[model samples]
Target chain A: MKISVQADAFDPGAELNAFSAGAAGAGAVVSFSGVVRDEGGRLSGISIEHYPAMTGKAIGAIAAEAVERWDLSDALVIHRHGDLAPGEVIMMVATAARHRAAAFAAAEFLMDYLKSRAPFWKKEYHADGAEWVAAKDSDEDALGRWAG
Target chain B: MKISVQADAFDPGAELNAFSAGAAGAGAVVSFSGVVRDEGGRLSGISIEHYPAMTGKAIGAIAAEAVERWDLSDALVIHRHGDLAPGEVIMMVATAARHRAAAFAAAEFLMDYLKSRAPFWKKEYHADGAEWVAAKDSDEDALGRWAG
Candidate 1:
């Protein structure tokens, strides 16, 4: 298991390759990447803020749960906080398991938790002004599927 | 959309990076990779065979269907045939969409089709002899979920 909460930009492709290489005995690998989207030409960029102390700990706990539940061989989560331009990757999750079902399920589970439950605040910038992005009802609904 | 059925080794990470770079306006990207698993110490390697003329066409058709059904920004599929050693990548599927749900669903759908419906044959080699690999009931059942 590996988790990183950093402001610096990371290469998703390079990280994925490294993760796959390190998963020695796994037969299936799944990855999900979330990129900042420009909703129309009105958007400029976005800024993400997090509680430094609690952010990593929270993500680590959820990732650990995913690993145990899915019997994953390995798992990785990387999230970026700070200013990000449209098309910039905001975060990524990867999972490895002996079977494809487990890997895919774990990756999806991690992504749902990160999107809806993670402690991150996002502010979207526009030409007129900037506003904090609100939690989406769709995201909340998506997260509900994973609830036990 | 891109589909390839080849015997030569390919870099999954490199391909993923290329695919993501080409997908403009997509906010979510998902990828699945299948690796050759060595079942215990008795297994040596495996050989995959495909119908040269129909393989690419079949994959392309399914990929196109996924893109239309899921409203995907892009989709990619790559499968390698011929002898493969343990830990080598056998195939990969990738999908990009404005939302994470569509991206994840399309990728999984592509994988299920590839696993059960794709025209590929496998022969697993052991220390003593080689035997033809048969389709699993689980894989068949997985495909049923996507049925119309």
Candidate 2:
């Protein structure tokens, strides 16, 4: 498993290729990329902040849980901080397993944890002003589906 | 939407990159890749045969349904035929949408359909002999999840 919390932008496809190459023995691979959306063209950009000290550790633990739960051959999470323009990639998760179901489940599990549990703050900037994004009840509900 | 049934070996990562790049403005993108598994090191390789005339049309119809159902910004499916070594990619599906749920669901839906309904025949080759692979009951169950 691999986790990276960085300000530098990265290519999702390139990262995917690297992960797939490292996970050669796995029979299935699934990936999710979260991009900064324009919100019906009303948004200009988004700014993300993270606790550098805790970010990697928190994400790593989540990834570990997914790997164990799904018996994954490998897993990866990459999250970017700092200002990001619309259409930019903000975060990504990838999972590999012996079957497609496991791979897809693990990827979704990681994404849910990342949205609700990971220590990240986001602010969206639009024509009017910038606003701090709040945790959506829907996101919380999404998290609930995975609860034991 | 794009669907290809080919004999040529294509790079999954490269294809993903191209698809992602073209699917700009979408907030979420999901992808799944199926690789040939060695199965306890007993399998030598796998051979896949397809009805070339109907394969593309059938897959394209499935993809169209997913796009409409999920309100996808884009979708892609690629399947390779002929002989494939263990660890070689057999097929891939990708979906882009405004949210992660739709993207993930569409990708999974496409995969379930491809596994159970696509016009492809698979035969696994082992040290002893080769066996024609049959559709799993699990695959049928998986397809049922998306029924109306």
Candidate 3:
């Protein structure tokens, strides 16, 4: 497994390919990229904040746990910090496994964990105003399924 | 929606770019690729046969239905025909939506529908022998949940 937190946008495909490298017996590789969107211009951009040390450790822990939970041949995770404009990719999660079930599940499972567990503050830039977007109660609710 | 049965491989990032084209409202785009695995060293290639007209129509129709079921903005379905060697990709499913849920669910649903409903025949070539591999009964079992 590999994890990186950076200020620059990264190629999710390349990251996924790197994860699946040397995985000859691997039958499936699944990945997800979280892109910054305008929300149809409902929101313009998002400024994310994080504590470098704790954030890195937290994310690493999540990736490690994911590796244990799934029969993954390999995995890659990349998440960006600092300011992100609309249409920029915010994060990516990729998994390679010997079967489709493990790959697909691990990819989604990681994203769900990231959205609800990763400690990052996102301030939404909106046409109306800018505000620190609190983690949604609904997002927390969604995370519950995985925790149990 | 774009549906094609090809002998060539595809780039997911490029296909994703096309899927999100002209759809500025798309906030999240999710994709999945199924590649050929090293089932055997002598597995030089395999020939994929499908009912061309019906397969394309079924996939398009399934994608259209998935868009409704998941409220997707756009979807693309591409699969291969003829001979495909190990390390070659077999199919790609991409979906764009206003949220991650719609994008993720729809892409998965499209895959389930294709695996069960599409009329595709696969013949495997190996050193020991050559055999025709039909879509499994368990694959049909897997699709049942989607209909419900």
What is each candidate's DockQ, to 2 decimals?
Answer: 0.72, 0.69, 0.50
- Model 1 chain A lowest lDDT segment of ten: A34-43
As a whole number from 0 to 100, the lDDT of residue B81 in candidate 3 is: 88
True contacts kept of 2: 0.66
The residue-by-residue lDDT of candidate 3 on B39-86, one tens digit each, is 657686788988977887888789889988888777888899888888
Position A135, candidate 3: lDDT: 76
Against the correct fold, how does model 2 do in TM-score? 0.97
Best prediction by DockQ = 1
> Candidate 1's error at B101, in angstroms?
0.7
Put down candidate 1 lDDT per residue, A65-95, tens digits, no spaces. 9999999999999999999998788999999
TM-score of chain A of each: 0.95, 0.97, 0.90
Best to worst by DockQ, what's the order?
Answer: 1, 2, 3
Flag regions of model 2 displaced more than 4 Å. Answer: none
State the lDDT of candidate 3 residue by residue for A3-120, as single tens digits. 8889987776556555554455676776677777777668878999888878778888888877788867777778898899887778877777776777777777788878877777
The DockQ score of candidate 3 comes to 0.50
Q: Return the TM-score for each candidate structure.
A: 0.97, 0.97, 0.92
lDDT of 1 at A107: 92
